[model samples]
Target chain A: MPRKSSRPTVATIARDLGISPATVSYALNDKPGVSAAMRARVLEHASAIGWTPHSGAQALRRGRSGNIGLVLVRDPEELSREPFYSAVTAGIEAATSAHGFELLIRFVRGGADDEVDVFRAWSHQRRVDGVVLLDLAKDDHRPPVLEALSLDFAVLGHYSGPEDFVKVTTAEPADAATVIDHLLERGYDGCLQLTGPFEYAHEGRRRELLARLCAERGIPHLHVPGTYTVDSGYRAFQAADTSLSARPAVVTSSDLIAVGALRAAAAQGVAIPRDLGLVSWDDSLIAEVTSPSITALSRRPFDMGRAAGDLLAQKIDGRIPGGSTIENSPAALIPRGSTARP
Target chain B: MPRKSSRPTVATIARDLGISPATVSYALNDKPGVSAAMRARVLEHASAIGWTPHSGAQALRRGRSGNIGLVLVRDPEELSREPFYSAVTAGIEAATSAHGFELLIRFVRGGADDEVDVFRAWSHQRRVDGVVLLDLAKDDHRPPVLEALSLDFAVLGHYSGPEDFVKVTTAEPADAATVIDHLLERGYDGCLQLTGPFEYAHEGRRRELLARLCAERGIPHLHVPGTYTVDSGYRAFQAADTSLSARPAVVTSSDLIAVGALRAAAAQGVAIPRDLGLVSWDDSLIAEVTSPSITALSRRPFDMGRAAGDLLAQKIDGRIPGGSTIENSPAALIPRGSTARP
Candidate 1:
C-alpha cells in the first residue's frame, strides 16, 4: 500500500506539488504526459495523503467484483428479533474480509413453493457465485433443483442423504442429545421443549434427538409446539406442567426462547435453573445479554460462517465432489446459569 | 400464469386421470402431438393439477442461469448466522419471486482493494445482471467502480451523488434529527448518544445529526465511541461519566447499543426513564424484546430491500439514470417505556 496518510486528498497532493488537480489526476491514474520527476513528486505526495485510485478503477484490470451474496431463510423482514443469524454474518464477514469479498446479504421469505422459485431466480441471474442455504426443510426441494441446474452452491444446514448437495451444517440432533443427557444427569426429569416452526428440517432432527436421548434414559417426556419466539416461550411456560410432581425443566431450541422462558418463569415467581433448566441452540450475544446467561449449544458464528464460505469456495472452484452432504459443523453444548445444579 | 393444481405432479395426475406419466410429461411440455383434443385435455388437467415443467428444463433451453447472485461482505469460507440480514433477504425473495428472480446469496469477505476484483471476476464470467451491497462504508468505492464498469448493482446505503451510484438508504440523518427533536421537546435536553462505528455512512450521518441537534439546542452532549456491538455499548457505559448533570436522560442510536446501555444502567441502578431514557434505531425485535421496550426509529428493512431491488431491476432493465437513489423509507420514532416521560 502507498505510505499511509491520515488526511490525504488529490487537491492536497496537487497543492503540495504546485500542479493543477488535472495533472495530479492524470499522474495518479498513470495516463502519462507528466515528466517522470513530476510523476515521482505526485506519487510521493499521493502516498503521503492516502490518495490511491478508486478500487473500481483497479478492479477493471484485476477482474473481480467486490461483491458476495449471503443467503438466509426468513430474511430480516419476517423476524421480530433473532440474534443467531447476525452472529453468523459477523463471523462470515470476518473471514470474507481476509479473502476480499463484499457480502451482499439478502433473504428469501415465503412458503416452500416460493423458496424454490426464489432460489432458482437468484441462481439464474448469476448474482452470486454460490448460494448458501440455511434452516433447510425436510426433503428440501432445493437440492433437487440445484442438482438439475448448472448452479454452484452450498448448504449451511444438514439434511437426509438424498439430494446430492454441498452443505455446512451442525450435528444439532447429537448436540440436543448431549444437552438432554446433561439435563437428565442433573435430575431434571419432565421437560417442555421450545423450538422454531416445525417446517424446518432441523426441528424434526432436534425432536428426534431428544426422543432418542429420552428413550436411552428410559424417561417419558412431553412435546410442545414452539415458534422460537419469546412470546411462544412465555406461552409454553404458561402451559408447561410446572406442578411439583411433574415440574418441567425447559430446554428451548433457541436462546431467545430461553430468555422468554426465564422472564415468564420470573413472572410466575419461579427461579432460574431451579424452577427451570433452560438450554438453547446457537448461542449468540443474546445468551450473554440475558439476566441469567443461557446454557446453549455454543457454535461460533464466525467459524460457522467460515465453514459455509469454505463449502461455497469449493463449489465456485468446481472442486466440490458432487454429492448430497457437504460439510457438518459440530454443535457443542455450553452450560450457563440457565441449566445448573439445583 | 398456470392454473392452480390440486394434483399437480406426474404421479398424481397420472393416478387421477388414468394416464401414463410419460404421456403426461410429453403433453404438459407440449411435445409433438397426441390428438389436439387429448393435448387440450392434458394441458387443462395438468394446469388444474398444478403441473408445470421444472424451471431447470426451461432455463436450460433458453440458456438462462436460474440464479441471482447475492454478494455478501464475508470471507468465502464462512457459515452465516445473522438473522436480520436473513430477514432482509426474505424481503428480497418476496420481490424476486414476483419478478421470477431466484435468490443466490453468498459471502465474499475480502479487503477493500481485493473485494471488487471478485465482483469483476464474477461479471467477466457471465454470472449476474447485477448485485446488492450492504454494510457500506462512507465514501464507498464500489458504486463508482460499478458505475465505471457499466455494471448492474444497488447498495443498501446512500452514496454522496447520483452522478455515479445506485443506493437505497433510509436517509438516516434526517431520521436521526426527527428522533433528536422528539427527545428535546420532552425536556430530555441532550442525549448520551451510543451509535455504531462512525465509518458507516448511516452512523456518520447519525452522529452528525445528533451533533447538529445538540449544537442547535445549545445543550452539552457526549458520545461514547463504539461499533454496533453490544459489548462495546456495555464498555462504553462502564466508562460513561456518572456525574449528575452530564448523565443523559435519553440514550440514542442502534438497538444493540441501547441494549448495552440498558444493561449498564441496570448494573448501575439507574432507573429507566426515571433515571435514564434510552432511544434506539432499527426497531428490530430487539426494540420490542428489550425489557421496558426501547424507543426506536423504525427503518423498514423489507421496503429498503425492495427499493434496492427496484433500483437493481431498473439497472438490469437499462433504465438506470446515473446510480439513482431512492430514500424509500423514513425512520419513524416508536416511543416505548424505555424513553417514557420522566
Candidate 2:
C-alpha cells in the first residue's frame, strides 16, 4: 500500500498531463466548462495514476460534506430500550447510503438548548449537507434555530413552522379516531390513553384527537402522561386501575408502554381482552411476542425514515422535493388477543 | 443571521487585523508560534465577528475530522427488532459527544465485501478519525483491510488476527462454564444450546466452550444454529423438542431467541423450570418481562459500547490508550422464574 504522502493528488495528475489545474479539475468533476475529449483524457489519466479526490478538499470546494445529520434529543436509557428509533435509523441509513451520504448522529442528553447547539455547530462547521429531525416537540425551538442558520433539514413529524420545511408525517388526525373507533367497536365503555411525554407534538396532537373523538362518542376518556418506557407504562396502568371505578380499555402511544401495562395487568390478575383491552401504537416484534399478543397500530418506522432521508437528500441537491409533506402508509391496527374480545 | 459567504473566515479576520492568515490561524488554533497578546486579540476579534471554524477547512488544515464511525453489517429486519445494537450505539454516542466528537454510522445490508467498500471509501475520504467494529467473524476480513488503509479502529468483540488491535470484550470462556455449572446444579442431565449464527466469533467461542464443558460433565450437548431473531429461536426449540427423547435445559445466545423459545414452550404446554429450564444470553427488558420471566446472563452492552468509544477516541488522538484489552464488567447472571425451580 502507498504511504499517505505518496498517494497521487490532483496536482500530480495535472502536472503529469501538462494541463492547467483548473482545466483538470473541471474535467475530472464533469463540469460543463471542460470539453468532452478533455474530460475523458483527464478521467483516464486520473484513473491510471490512482488519483482519488480528497474528501475534505472536495467538500470545501463544493460546499457539500456528503453527510446527513440526525440529532436525537432523548433519554439514553429510553433510547436503548425502544426499537422504534432504531428501526427509523436503519431506514435512514438504507436511504442515505444508497445516495452516497453517511448518517451523522448525535444523542443530546439535555433538552432543546443542547439540541439547538448541535444544529448550530453542524451548520457552522458545514459538517452535514442536510439533517433529519425527530421527536419534534410542541413549541419546538429547533426549526427556527435551524432556519436562522440557513441549514436545510427534513422533520420526521409535523412541523408547525415554515411551509418550505420538508415533513414525513405518519401520525395523522385520523389515527386517534381509528383507535377510538376500534375501542368503541370492541364495546368498550371507557378509554385510558397512556401517552408519551406531553412535550412531544405528536403526543399532544394524539391526546387532543383522542379527547375530541371520545367526547363525540360519549366515551369517558382518561389521559395519563408518561415517558416512552415500560416502567412508565406500568405505573400509568396501576394509577389508572386504582383511581377509576371500572377497568378501561388502554391505548398506549408506544409498545413499550403497552408491555408495562401488560405486566401490571398480570400482577393484578386482570385478564387481557377479558377484564381489560389494550392497543399499542408503533407495532413491533415485542407486540407480537407478548402473551395474549398486544393489539397494535403498525406505522412501519423504517419506511418513514427512508422517506425522510429521500426528502433531505433532494433538498440538499437543490431540488424542490416533490412534496413537502410525505404521508406514510396509514397506520394499520393489527387486532390480536389483547383486543380480540367484543 | 449572517449570510453563508459573509461569515468570517480566518483570511477575513487576518485582513481586519492587518496580520498574515498563517499568524491568525496559529493564534486561533492555539499553536505555539503566535504571541500571547496576539492570541488573545485574535480570540476577542473572532468572537466579536461570531466566527466559527469552517469544519471542512479546519479538517484539511489539521488532518482530523472529529468524527468516529461505526459500521454494522446485519439484516435491517434483525437490526430493527434487536435492542442490543441500539443500546451500544447510544453508549457510543454518549462517550463520543462528551469528547466533542460525532458518531457516523453506516448499516451494510450485504456481507464482507460491502462492509470493506465502506471502509475503503471512509479511509479514502478521511471521513472518520476512527471506527468501532461489531459482530466480528472467526476469520474476520475487516481488520487487515483497515490496517492496510491505516485507519484507526476498535473492536467490540475478540479479534483472532493482530495483537495490536484494541478489543473490548464482554464475553469470556467462563461465561459458558457458569451456565453449565448452573444447569448441572439444577439437575439438568442434558443441554440444548440455541446459538446465534456460527459465523460470529463470539458464537463460535461460546459453542466450543459449551461443548467442552458438557463433555467434561458427561452431559449430552445438542447445538442448534440460527440467526439472532425470534423466529430462529422458536424454530430451533421446536426442532429440539421433536428430536430429543428428553427435554434438556435450553440456553440461548440472545433474549429475542429466548422469547421465541418461551413462546414455543408455552405452545407445547411444557412447564418451565420443572419441565424445561431455560436461560437466555444478553439479558434485556424482554427477558425480564417475558412470561415465566426468563433467567438470563446480563451483559451490559451500553457499558461495552462506551468503553469502545473511549478506546477509539484515544487511538485517534494518538494515545496508546493505556490497555489493549478492556474487560467489561463480567456478565452477571440474573436468575428469574425460568430457573426458579432449581
Candidate 3:
C-alpha cells in the first residue's frame, strides 16, 4: 500500500479559496447566509479539494433531509430466511437513489411494545423524511400513531380500516380470490391453505377468502397456522397431513411456503400437481428460481418499492394534500409445474 | 393518538430538573464541567422521564464518538439478490451490539477512486470509531491509508498482499477439503464443485482446494464457475454436463451455488445420492431449511458474528496489542438428506 499525500479538508479548501470555514459549511448546506458568488467559489474549491458535509448535521438543520427510514416489522431470523423484504428494500433503494435520498433502514422487533418505542423514536426525532411501514395488523397501533403525528409514510402489504394513509401493496383477497376460484373450478374437492401468521394483513385475507369462497362452493379446507418461511410451510404441510381426512391439494401464502409444501410432498412420496396442486404468493425471482418452479401469484416488489417511494415523496413534499388514498397495485399469476387438479 | 405527555426533549428535561440546558448537555456528555452531584440530579430526573440524548446532536461532537462504520462495496441489487453479505453483516452487527457499539452502514458504488473520497470524509470527520471493510481485491487500496491515518478497522474475507490485518473468516479450503473427503469416503467415485467467481477470495480458495485434493486422491472430478445464486448454479451444471467424461456423483460448493446445482440436477432428471450427492458451504439458515436439507459444512454465522464483534470491540477499546487475528472456530459438518452413498 503506497502512502500518498493527505487529501485536503474543509479547512484547506477555505484557505485556498480565501474563505472562512463557517462560510464553507453554509455553502454546503445551501443556507441563506452565503452569497451566490461566495458559495460557488467555496463549492469549486471544495470540489477540487473535496468537501463532504457531516450528513447528520446537515440532516438536523434541513428538516427535509434526504433520508427515508425503513421499518420492517418481522422476526430478524425470519427475514434472513426470506427474500421478499430484501428485494422490496432493493427496489425502494432504486427509487430513493434517483432523488439522492438515503434509506435509513432499521428493523423493529414487532411485538407491540418494541414497535412503539421504535416508531416513536424514529418519527419524533425526525430521523426520516418518511418511513416504509410493513405488515400492518387489523387494529394497527402504528397507523393511529403515524396518523396522529402526521408523519409521511407508505405501508407495504397492509391496508385495512385506514383510508387516510398512503400504501403500496399488491392485491390481497383479490389474488387469493383468483387462485382459490381457480382451485374450485378445477373440481378440487378439498383444499389446504398454508398461510403466514394470521397477524399478517395479507395472509389474513388469504385465509378469509379461502374459507369464504370454499364455503360458497361447499369445499372444506385445513388452514395451517404458518409464517412466511419454508420451515413454516413444511410444518404446515405436516400439520395438514395429520389433521386432514385425506391429503388435499394445497395453496400457500408465499413462494417460500410453496417450496416447503413441494418438499413435504416429495418427502411423503406425494406427487406434485398430480397428487397435490399448489399455488403461492409473491412470484418473484424465487418463483422461477425453484425446482419444478411452483406456480405463483407474483408482484413486482421493485415496482411496488418505486411506487411507495414516489407516494412518500408526494407526502414529504405536501403534495398529497392530506387524507388521500392509493388503493393498491394488483398481483399477477405466473403458472409453472406446481398447480394441477387432484 | 394521545401524546402520553410527550417524550422528554433536551428542553423538557432541563425545565423539569430546573437546570440550565448547557448543564444537561454537559451531564449527558459526561464532561468534567459538571459536578458529580449535578450529574446525578440530571441523571435521576432524566431516567425517571426517559430522557435519552438525541443521537444527531451526539454525532456532531468531534473525535471518538463510539460509532462503527460498515462499508459495503456491493450495489443495491446485490443487497437483495445476494444473501451472503446480508448474513455476514448480520454477524458483524451481532459483534458490534454485544460491545455496545453502533454500526453506521454505507454503500459505495464502483471502485476505490471515488470511494477514497467517501473513506477520507468518514475518517477525518470521525464519523465512526472504526470501519469494517469487505470485498477486498488484489492490490487493495484501503489498508495502507487506514494505517497511515490511524483508523481502526476489521477486514472481512481477506486482504491484498502480506499486510497484517485483523480478519474473521471461515477456512473455506479446509471446509472444502472436509466435504470432498466426506464425499470420497461415502463411496462416490467422482464429484463436481460449483464455485463463486474465481476473483473472490473465499471462492478462490475453495476452487483450489477441490482441484488439488482431487488430484492428490486421484479422483476424477470437475470444477465449474457458479454465480452464487440458484439460477447461476443450475446453468453452470447444464454447461458442465456437455463436456464431462462422466456425470458427477457428488456436487459441492457455497450454499447458494449448491442450491442452483441441485435445481439443475433435478431439471436434468438426476436423482440425489443415487445419481448425485450434494453438499454446500456457509450453512446459512436457507440451506438447512431448503428441500432435502442440503448437507453442509456449517460456518455458524451467528457465532462468527459474535467473534468478529469481540475482536472489533477489543480493537475499539485499545485492548488488542497488535494486528487482529482469532483462531479457526472450527466448521461443523451438518449432514442432511442431500448426501449419501449410491
Candidate 4:
C-alpha cells in the first residue's frame, strides 16, 4: 500500500516559502509579528499545498475539543425499530455541523454504570466540549454523573433528577387529551392505552395524563403494559379479554405497536372502525400506509430533534435563555380512517 | 459559571511531586533518564490530580486522531423513514465503541460536492484517522476524491469506480433471485419490481439480476421506479395498469413501498395474497406488524454496518487481509401472509 504524505508542518511550509518557522507560525496564528505581504504569501502557498493546521494542535491551543458527545442507552434491535433516534440524530447533526463541531455518538447497552463510564472517559480525554443526553429513564444516572464531572450537557427529555441541565421536552403528555378526545368524539365510550414500559420517564407521564382525563369523563379505561415493539402490542391485545362485549377502543404508544393491533384485529376478523377503533402514536409513514390508515398524533419527531439540538448548541455556546426546560409544539391529532365515524 | 481548571501539565505534576519537569516528561514518555521510583511517583501523582494528557496534544505528537468519519448522503426525511440507517448506525457504533474509537457521523443532503468536501475536511483537518463510506452511486465522486487525497476508507457497498478503497458488499443481487423463485413457486407467471431510484448502485444490480432470472424462465417482468418511501410505492402501484385482467405480483424495494402498495390494494378492495401477492425488501419490524405481514428479504443492515466499521478499524490498525472487497452473507427470503398460498 502506498503511504500518504504526512501533513505538511509549519517547518515544511516555511522551507517551501523560504521563511523562518517562527515567522510562519506568527502569520498563521495572526500574532501581528509578520508583514501583510509575507502573511499573504504564506497563507496562499499553504492553501495551494492543502495545509490545514492539525485539529489536535488547534484544540490544544484553544483548550477545546470542539465536539459534542451523545450516548444512546438502548439495545440495537430496539433502537433500529424506532425512528425517533434517527430523526433526533439528524437534527443534532445539523446543529453540530453548522457550528463546525462534530458529534460523537455511541450506543451502549442500557446500564447506568456503562453510561457513567462513558462520561468519565469523555471527561478525562476531553473528547467533547459538551454532551446531549437522550432517553431519560427513571432514576436517571447521567445528569448527576455529568454534573459531578463539571461537564456541560443537555437532556433530550424532562428529568426530575437532582442535577441541573438544559432540558428539551416534547408535549407528549398533552397529546393524550387530543388522542382521547378524538376517540371519544368518534363515539368510542371507553378506550384502552397500550403504553410503553413504565420504566421510561415519558411513558409514566403519558399514562397518568390519559388516566386523569378518562377519570374526569367517568369512562372506564385500562392501561396495558407494552414494550414498544410490535410483538408486545400483539400480546397486549391478546391479553385483553375478548369476552367483554364492550371492548374498548385501542391506542398504542408507537406506530409499530398500532400496526400489530391492526394485524391482530384483521386475524380476528374484526373490521376496523366498525368493530374496533385504533390510533397509533408518532405519525410516521407507516401509519398512513397501513390499511385504514391508522389515526395518529403527529409528534413531529424531526422538529423535536431539531429543538433539542438547538438547545444543546445554545447551552454549549453559553447563550441559553432563562429557562432550563423548553416545551416544544404540542402534537396535533391527525384523524384517519381508523378513527372515522362508524 | 465557574471555568474548569486547565488540564494538569507536566510542570504542575512535577512541582507537586518535587521533581524536575524534564524528569516528569521523560518518565511519561518512557525515556531512559527517569528513575523507576520517580516515574512511579509522578504517575501516581498525575492520576491523583485527575490529569490527562490532552488528546489534541497527543495526536499532534503521534500524528493520528482516534476517530473514524462516516457521512450519510441522503435527505433527512428519506433517512428517517428507513430503518436501514439506524440499524446500520447501531452496528457501526458497536464496532467503533468496542475499539475505543468514536464514529463521527454526518447526514449530508445529497450533493456530490458536499460529500467530497467532508472527506477533504477529515483528510486535512486530521479529524479522523480513517473513514467509512456508504451508498456507492453510479459515477461516484467519493472514491476518486478520497483516492486523490490518499485517505484510507472502506466503502459499505461494492464500487467499480476508480479507487482502491476496501469494499464490503451484501449479496443483494442473489436475493433478487430468491424473491423471483419464491414468486414462481407461488404460480405467478409475471411480476413487477418496484425498485428504488435507479441512480443508487444497488438498485441497478438488483433489477438486472431479477430481470435476467425472469427472462431465463420465460416469465414476464416489469421495473417500476420507486423512491424507497411509502408514498412512492403507492404511486408506483397506482401508475400500474389495472385494466390487465391478470396483473403481475408485486416486489418492492423496501418495506415502506410494500406498505404503500398494500394501501393502494386496500383502496381498490383487492385482497392480499389472493388478488395480489406482495413482497417487500429489508425485513424490519413493520413488515411483521402490517396486515398480512408482508413477505420480505432480510438485508441485515446492522451486520452490513458492523462489517464496514470493522474493516475501517482494521485498515486503521494495518491488519486488513488480502482482498479489497468482502461479500457479506446473502440475504434470505422470509415468507409470510402477504405471499401465502393463493
On lDDT, the candidate that comes out on top is 2
Per-residue CA lDDT of model 3 for A40-147, tens digit only, reads 888787776655655556555654445676766566555655667776777776666555665665554557666666567655555556777777777777877776
* TM-score for the B chain of model 4: 0.91
The number of the candidate with the highest TM-score is 2
lDDT of 3 at B113: 57
Query: lDDT tens string, model 4, B1-342?
Result: 334744577889987887788998898888997789888988888889878876787777776778888888778767887887888888888887778788898888867678888888887788887778776787777776676766778888756566456778878767778888898888666778888888878787778888898889887778888787778888999898643336357888888888888888888898888877899878987786677788998888898888888887887777874246779887888999888875
Let me know the DockQ for model 2.
0.51
Ranking by lDDT: 2, 4, 3, 1
> Which ten-residue region of model 3 chain A has the weakest summed lDDT?
A1-10
TM-score of each: 0.68, 0.93, 0.85, 0.91
The candidate with the higher TM-score, 2 or 3, is 2
- Please give the distance, in angstroms, between residue A127's alpha carbon in candidate 1 and its true position after superposition: 9.3
Over the stretch A195-221, how does candidate 1's per-residue lDDT look in tens digits?
A: 777777878887788877777776656
Report residue B88 deviation for candidate 1 (angstroms). Answer: 4.2
Docking class of 4: medium
